[model samples]
Target: YRTAAASASLPTFLLVGPSGSGKTAFATLTERTSIAQTHTSTQPLTIEALLPSPHVPASSHYRSPGDPAYERSRRFLLLDTPGHGKLRHYATASLSDPKSIRGIIFVVDAAALAEEPGLNEAASYLHDVLLSLQKRYTSATSSKGPTGIPVLVAANKMDLFTALPANLVKHQLEKAITEVRTSRAKALRDAGAALSGGEDEVDEEREWLGEGGEGHFEFSQMQEIGTSVSVVGANVLGGKETGSVDGWWEWIGENL
Candidate 1:
């Protein structure tokens, strides 16, 4: 009964990332089919969206276009959460209990990721998101384990001259995430010591973002826990010559 209700819900994709990363822009473009001027979001927004033409949902590839089930499979929900540091609780809460969430799209400004602060902030937030997913996967009691909720690292603002290419964006993020994982583990150890008045085993394995080792963190490591991470580049705004997100839409279609 409960499982059936959950299965009947729309396939939802949660849009998350740091502020000014074009999350709202991409969300609006996806919902409206054209870019609109968007202000920073103060609250979460939910929008119903259909897969655009020329992109077929993976689940409906064998069905004809006119089939109602095929069309219905193309429909899903885009849940945009506030990306501000103080308002990210909405995203975290949603991740903690992802009832209908089918995927996560973490939008990031490609240009911003070229700098130190922007890179660090994005990496930190991504680390925590991945960790939450890890916890969910590892703690599942079901013999079959939890369903994998894949992640799409949407590299946005490709129109900017400073924007990193999609490949570099992936590499940079992986490198930065390695640092984030190390720092986080160290912080957890220190906190545990302070609380216990001595060194103590904190079960760091559960908190670690990827395979436990000194090896560089790669998104592929997530596959062990059932999640797959992909990085796709697209631009939501910046005029006729540099505005498009077909890659993102296609990725969404594949997942849908």
Candidate 2:
């Protein structure tokens, strides 16, 4: 039991995104050192993985590679949740109960994000994820507040010719999330208006993401709530034999 508890307490990173956005591919590559032919996952998968060589964990950067503490710091759990719409409760549950969660990796198909439908789907899911984080921060009762959970927007499939660059991915997502925020607030108001009484007034403030203003929603806005967002471009396949996820791994090392 003690052994199991120790392993369970390892820092965990949540992997979430829209379907076919390469969440499973990234997980498989990280676990096996090679990408496999992955199908759409319907269930959440948890795997123990080590941070690869040459990239030291931020927590133990000063220690030499052979040190036991340095090696132990590289240990962590990768929790890959299903990206399918109906299967997202696993991700939501993890967010709500993020005891061991160190960070969130939201993978996106850079090329798909260039189109309207794909962009909207990714943006909508991302909006909800960030909103949950915002709510978690605002609802904390302690003076120091809860520990911040940073986010990494992994822009996958960068090898694709049509893939949007990392900067454009960041810009477009912010724009789409702004629209999603507006429509969601409008929806809440419409629903409340349809009701006769104000007995159950909707808490729009709680539902609103970022500062309550008419301005656009940027990832920077999350800073006020203690969550930092970053977008890094990478390819899980198509570049070289193994593809380039060095940037993603580096980001993970930094956060680790």
- Which prediction has the highest lDDT against the true structure? 2
lDDT of 2 by residue, 1-256 (tens): 3387777988999999999999988888877855589999999998888899888899998899889899889988889999999999999999998868999999999999999899999999999999999999999999999999999999999888899999999999999999999999988887887784554367899999999888899999999998999999999988665358888888889989
Please, what are the lDDT tens digits per residue for candidate 1 over residues 99-175?
A: 68999999999999999899999999999999999999999999999999999999999999999999999999999
What value of lDDT does candidate 1 attain over all alpha carbons? 0.91
Steric clashes per prediction = 0, 0
Q: What is the C-alpha lDDT of each candidate?
A: 0.91, 0.91
User: Which runs of model 2 end up more than 4 angstroms from their true locations?
Assistant: 197-200, 241-243
Per-candidate TM-scores read 0.94, 0.95
